[model samples]
Target: MALLIEWKSGGNRFMERCNGALEAEILACVEGIALALHWTMLPFEVETDWLTLTQMLQSREKDLSASAHLVREIRRLIDGDREISARKIHHAQNQYY
Candidate 1:
């Protein structure tokens, strides 16, 4: 399973490029995506519009660790596929960053 980390800013029109929701919800979305993929490596990719989510995953904090662990579990499940990568893809032409 591939993990996609997304950051949704709380209902800020100026920050429209980001999702307007709590971090947990965004993380849940990532988990859901992983489950959908059945923890398969198979060249999977995760994408998020915000850079913060990506950076958070790299942090050493306990909270961050849990989230990262969830993602890692998915990776381990699909160990053989070994083609996972995450990147930011432009939402819509008019969408924010």
Candidate 2:
């Protein structure tokens, strides 16, 4: 899967960068977690280090069409079986309001 970023940086920031290796690794981890959770009928949470990637996967961004495809695959695997969500945290990036 790919990564997506959504940020509100004091309404001044217009630049962004993503760590390709980290994103790929996170996506793989999410996929593995989903597969592991599939055995149980009970719903569970799927957490990731990259919250923006989660949101974008759920929202399915158009500009990042390539990434969207991978997200769609993950969504399909988890479809109707569980609920998935995204959460962002304060990292090196500017604090979001």
Candidate 2 residue 91 C-alpha distance from true site, Å: 7.5
Q: Best candidate per lDDT, number?
A: 2
Candidate 1 lDDT tens digits, 36-75: 4664434555556655555554344555443455545544
What is the C-alpha local distance difference test score of each model?
Answer: 0.48, 0.53
Q: List, residue by residue over 12-70, the lDDT tens digit for candidate 2.
A: 32325434754573556455556555555555555555766656655744636446555
By TM-score, who's the top model here?
A: 2
Locate the minimum summed-lDDT window of 10 residues in model 1. 7-16
Per-model TM-score, in order, reads 0.41, 0.51
After the best TM-score superposition of candidate 1, give how far the Cα of residue 65 lies from its true spot, in angstroms.
9.4
Error of 1 at 47 (Å): 0.9
Q: What is the lDDT of residue 53 in candidate 1?
A: 55
